[model samples]
Target: MDASNPGEAPETDETLPPDDPVVAPKARSIRPLVMIWRQALKYPAQVALALVALSITAAATLAIPAYFKVLIDRGFSRGGDIEGINHAVELLFGVVVVLGIGTALRFYFVSWLGERVVADIREKVQENLLRLAPGFYEENSPKEISSRMTSDTTLIEQVVGTTVSVALRNTLMAIGGTAYLFYLVPQLTMWMVLVIPAVVIPITVFGRRLRNVSRTSQDRVADIGAMVTEVLGAMKIVQAFNQESRERARFNAAVEDSFNTARRRIMIRAAMTALVIMVVFGAIVLLLWRGAVGVASGEISGGTIAAVVLTAGLVAGSFGALTEVYGDLLRGAGAASRLAELLHEEPAIAPPARPEALPVPPRGSLSFRNVSFRYPTRLESPALRDFTLEVQPGETVAIVGPSGAGKSTIFQLVERFYDPQAGTIRLDGVPLTSADPAEIRKRIAFVPQEGVLFSANARDNLRYGNWEATDDEIWEAARAANAERFLSELPDGLDTFLGENGTQLSGGQRQRVAIARALLRKAPILLLDEATSALDAESERLVQDALERLMADRTTLVIAHRLATVRAADRIVVMDEGRIVEQGSHGVLASAGGLYARLAELQFGATEAA
Candidate 1:
């Protein structure tokens, strides 16, 4: 990002640190000033108002030092009249009042700009994340996303809210003061001009190191956050394993890395600070010494020396401020670049320019026509290869397979979570890829393993499947899932709060609640992925009865690890290594003594074999 100073060149990629040395060795190219300006330009009227206020504030500040020049030289010089001093003092007081008001207004407007810009950047980044492909999250963590929205935005807020205005005010003041110095002593102003580069050089050059350190520090902080989130989310597992000390040690190391990087940044900033202060003030002091000698030799009046000194001091202070602003620009530039990468990433899955709409009421006839799929990261092995299947509407098909036999892959493809690399999946004879993914998902209800639940009321959790469901409808769904009995036993019943991940409820209870949510969806198609796995024998019997009833008139896909679950299924498709090994009714498949028969006899024993 180009900074306020046009003369100082911007840092290139070679100056920046890489995100990861092995995977993403190349540094990212992102211009933060572009984001800032884009946001600033969004509210042009507000920006205009703030800039006007800033201009008035800068003018007021420049007037103060000029007022002091008149006070010390013309008004209070030796042998000057006391009345002149009194008049000068009144003028100075008036300047102070104007400055006080200007500074206050400047603070209000600049801070407002900062807050608005931060909010816009955060909203944009979030929207981008939502549209991003699943692959993006696979590489980055939720912690990294959180950090970008928070700490990175805070850095941007500092740049927008504080640094920009400070730089502008000081810049104007410095220019005005220098002009005044030239009017008082043209020869002396030339020496002051020579000192400007001395201050600018260190801030520009050393600022590159600061930016690199800031990026590293932020990465370390994000690592710590990721570790904390992972451990906390699985606190039960962590405690069971007695890994508290291990987790703490990892977190401590992450924090120490962050601290070390921050220290490096601080050292560079401090050095830059010391350099600016010495170079600016030192040049002024040298000028002052020359001015005093010139005054003694009758070359200029005491008042002239005094006025020149006052303007030079104001200019010097402005230069010092510029140095600090330079550092912020560099640091903020890195932050902006990282944010832009996330915001600009295009999702691999996107709605077609003109997508075919689903039937208002879908008839769930599903077919896989020579469909093949392989995750992009694992392109060497196909998860599903030329898989072909067809089910008439309202048919219940059970899928039985060992692990990694493309069972889950089928569910994902059916829901349009991923597109098949070859051929197509169709719904009601229309290609699934051509249909809107949202439309396809809306017609399907998925009950995954382990029963995912949010920290919300029981009623609210069920209502998620059908947001507009009435209270009575929610109860009906719960009753169908056999959840109403336990729910009614609770003190608050439907209004009872389910703690995080439904931790307050037993495993069976959580599973029942999940089944209730699926029942509420009333989707034409149902997918059960070991939906009864968490339930105990009694609960499973009851819930299985409910699930059979739930699947009566809908097209259903069942992935069962247990043999008992598939006994009532219309047909069982046995799969091995991503291919269908056998397919037939359960009794027939068992009688045939194939893969299904082997699995069935393993669970049901010789009873099934006989």
Candidate 2:
């Protein structure tokens, strides 16, 4: 199948890291966090409430230090006045009560926003993923994509729920406390101001390094997740090959790599924290020493000294907290940027702005004209070379070819999964590209080599082909596909849960179920990809009978590997090296002694070829 345009470059090659899954682009800034901010803004009422509560809590926190100053000066230091002390104690209690209430509200609203925003983002990303063409998955790993959906979004949730709130609250405290410190003592405030530049410079330097490490750390973590999914999904193969030890070593290596990357990130964050703390609190100590001297000289009261000490501590602590939260914000930005890549991806195959409609009362005729194509991954060789064929309505044409001879490519083009680079394909006389893909596919039904079923009940799997099919209609189709007997014998009948990929059913039963699904589709055109190729003789006969019934009155295209399967086909087209070498009825092709005759001798013995 032509998975992508031969000339157009893949979208992932430009946006994603090259070759190495563990490598990631450096996070230059926190600007990518704006996407998260937009998602949070969707609930304005929650935002307003959270902000209001945060402000109230910050104000109340500052008020406590001021109240301490009042209590010391007017109550304890003023000849121990009982009434003044009682009044001060009561007011401090009131402030504490308000702070508790405000903090609770802030936590509630912010966490709600975090959960809601992540949920919405998941929905949007999955929706866009569904719209993307198969070409995207061919280029990118679904396992890596799954990690982004889980691990990356979790980082975003932490940022919204905890890091953002902590950063904002500390900012308010730092600014307000600084102003109050200045009011209390200009001399000390000026000294701390000089130390601010020292603290900020280290934060800026260490933070940049941290951002890069954090992004790489996330990539390594995603690599680990992808590796785990790959290994677990193929556990049976590993056990059969006796390669369990090798798989274990590979998983251990991935875990160690993830750990090493994370260690670098945390080390940078730790250094930033220690440096900012030493610079900020060292200045606070000097200020306190100066304040102590003033108290001894009677230049300032004891209460004034106490208030300066408390407020200065608050300001220094806020600066220290900012350094820690800054690291988390950068990590969140890295995650948001990765997710944004998927959310913003444009589908390479989409309906035209004004798509032409297919003709009603479907004629079911299909045609391919001078079609030449190559898969994007294999640009050196063509899958179909100048392929041209025409099928009349209600005719069954069987295609016979060796592996890589473009037999399946014909089905892919017919369904418009991809457009050929060099030719045009039409259905019912209308070009495939000119009409909406969904409308064109509605007229065709496909039954693949393996019967693909979802992890759902039998009824749901049957209805996947046509959701509106009634129970009576479903039973009728089941009978036509030779599936009614086993279905009726099932424990819950149609309601029975079919295991993943329908592992609960036998090979023949699964193929019959697939035929029943196509029967329910009720499309005028049917495409079968050797549905009974892997079945035993008895099973093959049953599936073949079911397929024959399904093909009656429908335009059918079948890829046949067994000579017996195509003997009844209206015409057999023999393909070799992506081109048709011969075309005729079974008897005529046998008499020609060409590629079909060769294939017949190999499958049906030399006597049958004659």
Candidate 3:
């Protein structure tokens, strides 16, 4: 086992009945059936319709035995009227029609109800997932969460739409058929019902085993799904590294693991079905022998005997079918339990019950005082310690530091992605904790290093910065970011579809689009984190020119490792090991022979500070 990830259990063909958190978490009881069924009740009209149709179908099925009894005893016996025989045959055909129509109606309503319920569940799960904070994902892989959304939800859809409906219809048939058996031949039915205990005993025992195994089986399938998602999402990485054979081996292992678990579940369910059929039919054969003796003595009519035998078959058949349904229900229960766990995950960050409003016309000032923080996933290492800095309105302050010096940490703190373990952070003189995260984020425009763009059109991608932006405004921002020329070159221009993650564009082009997005935000503060790090000289010069104009009236914090990029900052702050070691202009720092001077020496050589 890899000890680093306690949450990710090793994948194996043999797993315990229920996994941690998926079905039973921290000793908390999970009743997925009850929870899922209660949700099914949300659509009252559909539930009622399904119930009515189910009842009609059951009644029609029960009436078929009555028709058989009438045809034999009243119409086919000695001295029987021909007219009576014809009427009995017609009545039998009528009952057949009723059964078919009722069955169809029952199926329609039940399937419709199942589909509607599952759709609502999917929507709710996704909506809840959106609200959870990053810490939740630190422990849970996106692959697993996505598996729950697709594989698990598909299982639930089957359970809700098909399994539940079949189980209900069979339940009604079994009960109604058993009662009709008694009315047909009390003497034979008395002896026949005795085998009920025999059938019930094995069902109870095997069902427990199947339910446990079903949970494990569903978990294994989810593993396969998670693996597929992970490998496919990084297909380029896998091919580049020439790990295709290794990945295929891993994928095959997961698939076989899932299949093995399912095999066990299927075996258990099959055993249960076999035991039920053997006992139920064995009892019926004995009942038939007794009925034959009773008929020899004229104790029961032939018609009654026939109906009793048919009804007994119905009872046994319904119970046998239920064994299969039991497995599906258990699988569904496990899925619902997993979804419920996700829904219950509490986010580390949430809006206050009544958040204080931000100051009108946001003043572009930011401050951090004696702040300390550690990322949740890397709690052993501090990302920031005793960090203190202040940026005045309309000032461009550039932070220069080596890797892991907490340059990006400041941006995260300002964005309220994580709260500091110690000290306070404020914007516009209001503590960040006192205001809603949305309000704080709205006042600062952020352009991340990677320049993330969605699989969407150019217009939609740019409009993401300001959803309500007009066409003219979008074009205006694109022009300012030096992206309008390339955008117009595309066949469909703004409406052109950018492939996944904007794969159709070059790195420099993607960066320009990201800048355009931030420019369109029109916020009071701008955050640029190595935005020009990956650009070529030509792209850098052009982007820097556009950036100069964008930063003219806004407070800007720039993180740069290329000393030349930030040489013109109003003030440069040098940091190392999460603490600011020097603060000054380019000339002042170079002449003092400090850490900044040494860094400049390494990048540009000894004799020149330029």
1-610 in candidate 1: lDDT tens per residue? 1111212222343323444221122222224566687888888877887788788877777676666666667655668767877887898788788778877888888899899998998998899788766655654566656766787789889989999888888898888888887787788778877888887777767776776666666666656666677888888898999998998898888788778877987898889989989988988888898889989998977777877776777788888888778777767766776676566667767778888887767888899888889976678988897888888888889998888899988998888778988988998877887887778888999999889999998888989889999999998988888888888887798888989988889988898899999888999999999899999998889889888987888999999999788888987888887788899888788898788888888878969543
Best by lDDT: 2
Clashes by residue pair, model 1? none
- Model 2 regions lying over 4 Å from their true place: 1-26
Ranking by TM-score: 2, 3, 1
RMSD of 1: 5.3
Which sections of candidate 3 miss by over 4 Å?
Answer: 1-30
Whole-model lDDT per candidate: 0.79, 0.85, 0.82
Tell me the lDDT of model 1 at 141. 63
Worst 10 residues of 3 by lDDT: 1-10
Displacement of residue 211 (Cα, Å) in model 2 is: 2.0
Ranking of predictions according to lDDT: 2, 3, 1
TM-score of 1: 0.90
Better of 1 and 3 by TM-score: 3
The window of 10 residues in a row where model 2 has the poorest summed lDDT is: 1-10
Look at candidate 2 and tell me the lDDT of residue 76. 53
Give the TM-score of each candidate: 0.90, 0.93, 0.92
Which structure among the candidates has the greatest TM-score? 2
